[model samples]
Target: MMRSLLDHLLIVPIVLPLVVGGAMLLLGERRTRLKAGINVAATAALLATAVALLRRVNAGGVEVAVYLPANWPPPFGIALAADRLSAAMLVLTSIMALCSLVFAIARWHRAGVHFHPLFQFQLMGLNGAFLTADLFNLFVFFEVLLAASYGLLLHGSGPDRVKAGLHYIVVNLVGSSLFLIGVSMIYGVSGSLNMADVALRIAQMRDGEHLLLQAGAAILGVAFLLKAGAWPLNFWLPPAYAAASPPAAALFSVMTKMGIYVILRLSLLLFGDDAGASAGFGSHWLLLIGLITLSFGALGMLAAQNLPRLVGFSAIVSSGTLLAAAGFRSPAVTAGALFYLVNSTLALGAFYLLLELIERSRSYGADLLALTREAFGLDRLQVDDDDDADTGDAGVAIPAAMAFLGLAFVACALLLTGLPPMSGFVAKFVLLSSVLNPGGLTPDVGSGVPASAWVMTGLVIGSGLTGLIALARMGVRTFWAPSGRAVPRLRVIEVLPITALLALCVALTFQAGPAMRYFEAAAAALHAPHDYIRGVMAARQVGATAGVLP
Candidate 1:
């Protein structure tokens, strides 16, 4: 009974949101409070289920759990598998969705006709993408998310959002087309859509088949890279994210991560050292591209004139860092990267939410003043009227709301820049330390760390420095400069979500030891795919054996 219950729990994260979303579509828009209650309840349930699933996997000493939709075998029927990495992702997605939904209820949920339904569907798609064990299902989940995102992107109905949404839709559509073509080619060559079966078949294929598989994999990689916001392929991300409403932007932070998750999963499982000729096929290129993306993100951060775009670029930097670290193929580095991934996503999401509030506090003349200061070489300290006089005393009493916003803004800046005394700092330190000393005190000592690793280390530090400078400049402009603006009024609902996320970051910092251990275990599990394949395939075998007995 317990085993069956746990087995059913594996599918709840994927199914719950889907059912709720369809139900929400049937609810009338007038019942906003009812819809919100249902959405929040469903999200809470999903989070609880994800937590339970993670605990089960950890306590049972099992690395993977497989669920067959119809008790059919893998090559023919759909499969849903859960591992540490996927479970972690599901938990992260659920947390973000719940927080974003609560924040949305304050105002943004009423912005459009189907906000609740679209939001639920988006969660459904994201959960599905993370849990699916087959490449074709992965593509299906991608489309589901992308379609839902198109609606959410334009949820508030603004000119900026509409324009950006159109561009976002067109780009993703093209990527989707490429995704299908790649998956089709792989299916043609290998005669399987199940990832485990594909990996098994690829290992036994002849040289001719190897070339075809590589081409298909490359095309598929391009689609993933585009979604992952890689340097040249991600021009649309910043603008689109910038234009999105706050709640939508917060959720979109995890969307880019879905691409990273898939790439990491496939690259390690299919192209590991055990893949014969394809071993380490694209690792070097991933490292190089990752470094370039990191540099591009840093430059984008420095160039951003507003907070939203800055947060968007921060997402890119996080993605680049993860890709580069994973490219190293070391479990320790991967563990550190996973820790950093969680830290960065939380920090960036919080920053996006906080930015909207901060911007609202700016004076009506703030933009004009900035333009004048830049174009006409006017001094910011000069006073235009007696009411706007600069006291230069530095002893003015700060409003309670302004003080809170300032503190939150500082926390976000520290986290994004990987500064000391925060999770971001600890995450970066672990990653760099792991790269330099993979053996932990023994040190390989013979070959030394690769120059590419050295380059990545420099990029990591360089990006942090760049982010520090950019965020500090913005902070001074927003918080310190005499803008003659009143402190923005904030509601409890608006402030609660941002505070919750920052609190999580602080908690992560204090609990770094145990958190890092969990990620280390996850990375180890990911690197060893045999356990995963065995567990998935054994499920089908057990079902087959049971059928024969009956």
Candidate 2:
């Protein structure tokens, strides 16, 4: 019974937020302290749940939490499931959400409805998206999160904010609509919306049905790619993320992840290796696109003069790198990508919170670098002993916090650039190793592995070149340049989140063994969809048989 209880630990993270958000609505904006308290407690609870689940998953196998909505049969009802990968993502997202929430608490103003509630709802959506086993439920959760995100994105409601939010909104809506249409078509074809069931059906389909499956897969991939901020389809993300409030921007950083998560999940659970080749969509295409997008993002980062825009472009680069890892079609690469994804989210969340601190130090100026310089007093390249040591070191006073945040950000930069001592480095290393290994893409002879290997090397080198150049420029301008202002002190609230997120990055590095193991499990599961399909169909068949006459 206790084991069974642990199985459903996945739902706790999502449900806690929804409950908190709903309760906070009654408290309204008047009870600001109450709102803050609720949000902090709720987010912390969710984070704790995630941590618990992560430990359980690492120790055991996949931790599944099956919550059948309306208490219906498995086939007839929706189920919320959490595997190792999903649970790991839950931890990452919760950390991001918690940081953003803390930042919002300090920055919360008289903005109509309480900011905390919206934040909670958004968390609900994100957690739900990660945990859902039913495809339609995933869509519902995606929309739930997307709608909440629009509110958060447009929180300030300025002209630029409105414009940017609208673009994000319109693009996402189209993507969501496509998602719905695709899910419907999938159900029509497979007669089941459960992911495992659909996988089973797709495997047994005739050539004609296979074509339909291919089309559906393509459509699904397109929608998710757009959300993941893949090239040609990612035009809206940078502008919108840049335009949103700092906390909102931090939240959106993880939002691009939702799409990537779906693409990965679908690839692993539905398409498998066979689909990648048979559907005429080789994994190489993902690798090529990831390379192009990585290059594109690096260039954009280098070119952008504005701080927010630069961060936005950095997001694009991060997404591209992760996608490239996914495209490699190697479990080692996928695990590496997962490691990078979690690290990036944590590091970027800290960066966003730091950006907020920088903004506040300047009385909320839109000019990021100028504000950065003003806040840190870094107008010139050199620093003097008279200059406040805290400001020069990015406004963090706690020596450990400053060091950790800096180290984490630097690690993130290196990982994004494919550098060493970091998982990003290890990820690229594993990927390149796999690609270049004498064996090919096939497990036996390792045929075609050389081509993919070269692709990895080229991407790693290219993204690194562009990323390093851009990062060096940004670092000089933002952190090293001297300004005319003195370093201002940071509030505990502001300081806590950055410290927490940075610590998470360090923890990820140290605890990488468990993370790597989970990623391997997820990757292996993705490569072989047989277990997932078997589990869900068996559940469905058992339900149907239970209802039938003997």
What lDDT would each prediction earn against the true structure? 0.85, 0.71
What lDDT score is found at residue 8 in candidate 1? 86
Q: What is residue 82's positional error in candidate 2, in angstroms?
A: 1.3
**Could you estimate the TM-score for every candidate?**
0.93, 0.86
Which candidate number would show the highest lDDT if scored against the true structure? 1
Cα deviation of 405, candidate 1, in Å = 1.1
Alpha-carbon runs more than 4 Å astray in model 2: 1-8, 61-65, 109-112, 273-282, 359-412, 420-423, 438-449, 539-550
For candidate 1, give the lDDT: 0.85
**Alpha-carbon error at 296 in model 1, in Å?**
0.3
The superposed Cα distance between candidate 1 and the true structure at residue 143, in angstroms, equals: 0.4
Stretches off by above 4 angstroms in model 1 are 1-3, 365-394, 540-550
Alpha carbon deviation, residue 29, candidate 1 (Å): 1.4
Q: For residues 61-140, could you state the per-residue lDDT of candidate 1 as single tens digits?
A: 77787888776776678989999899999999988888888888877788778998899889988999999999999999
TM-score attained by model 1 = 0.93
